[model samples]
Target: MVALMCAEAVILGTNSKDYQIYSLGDRIFCCAPSTGIERGIMLEISNQVECQYRERGIKPTMDQVRDMLARKYENVSSENVLLVGQDRHGPHIYAMKGIGIPQTLIYAAKGKGRDDIIGYLMHNWKKSLNLAQAEQLVRTCLLVGENDYVNMCVIYKEKETWAKAVPQLEPVAIMAYDTESAFDDMTSMGSNLSN
Candidate 1:
């Protein structure tokens, strides 16, 4: 799983079913290496967070979520949770591992291929990236060529959260007699790669 703060929005991307992401009120939560027990824990916590938001009109802070996770650490000691949300302090990203203190960050990635994804983001991410660019960067980081679908969650500041499964186009295989010309042709105006 990967999550990044881009422009006025936070984007999360994942290609695995074991690490599912969920939207709770204005926040997004995801657990790594999810199992029945971990998923139940996440759902229960999400419900609590949502209820608080609905009844009090206040979003849960990262620290508060960390405390909640800390209490449930025994049940999900091997799993890590990543959260992204907006509050009075503005948008934030947090990473929590077991009973350790949560770390605030501009971006976070975990689970399989996390190192590679984090490396790519560190080199390619920029503060000026728009929503589309950020989503593309995440999709690229996931190496979506190998996966058929990429699940995404976007939390926009002061706006409703959006979540979807983006389908990836099938990789094309081509044999060109003239390699340079073929590359040029693919980069031409009408080609999908032109953009």
Candidate 2:
């Protein structure tokens, strides 16, 4: 169904307590959970933003980009996240609903267990977190939940006057470890529990 699946992006706003922690012109990176059909939507939206920026010699505002996506996507359902550059403003983060609603996220995660993840953030999120700290918090939430449903992590940061193309991170295995190796930990623990 081309349902836009899961994409995660974080935007620390002016009101954010950790805003001052990051330098003035850091780049905002948009990450797609995995390379697949679902990731296509995010790519297209980003492409559109880039095209508009190139033609206009200015980055489109979130609202403008949102409208463009809404028109292009029409009724297609899918998961999408965008952290495109905002002209003079800092980076803007948004999740585009299949129905074309560009919902802004403030330290929010989308996709499976989105509700629970949001709740978790509400309880544990701190205002003093820097960019890296915020990213770690998101990573921790996914890891602690053992959310196998999501497998993609992308980082977004805004730069000075122009938006730099943030690179995708190398894929890594998500594992639960208690100092023991994978096979050793699971098998040994299994035997003990059964006994």
Worst 10 residues of 1 by lDDT: 158-167
What does candidate 2's lDDT look like per residue over 82-133, in tens digits? 3333334544555665565666655545554567766777886765666566
Assess each prediction's global lDDT (C-alpha) against the native.
0.73, 0.49
TM-score, prediction 1:
0.70
lDDT of 2 at 164: 50
Give the per-residue lDDT of model 1 (tens digit) for 1-195: 788988878887787776777655455555454666667777787899889988999777756775776676654454356777775556778777656456788988877777888888899999888999998988887663366567888877654323435668899997658988877886784676555
C-alpha RMSD between model 1 and the true structure: 19.7
Query: What is the model-wide C-alpha lDDT for candidate 2?
Result: 0.49
Give the poorly placed runs of model 2, Cα more than 4 Å off.
1-40, 79-87, 147-195
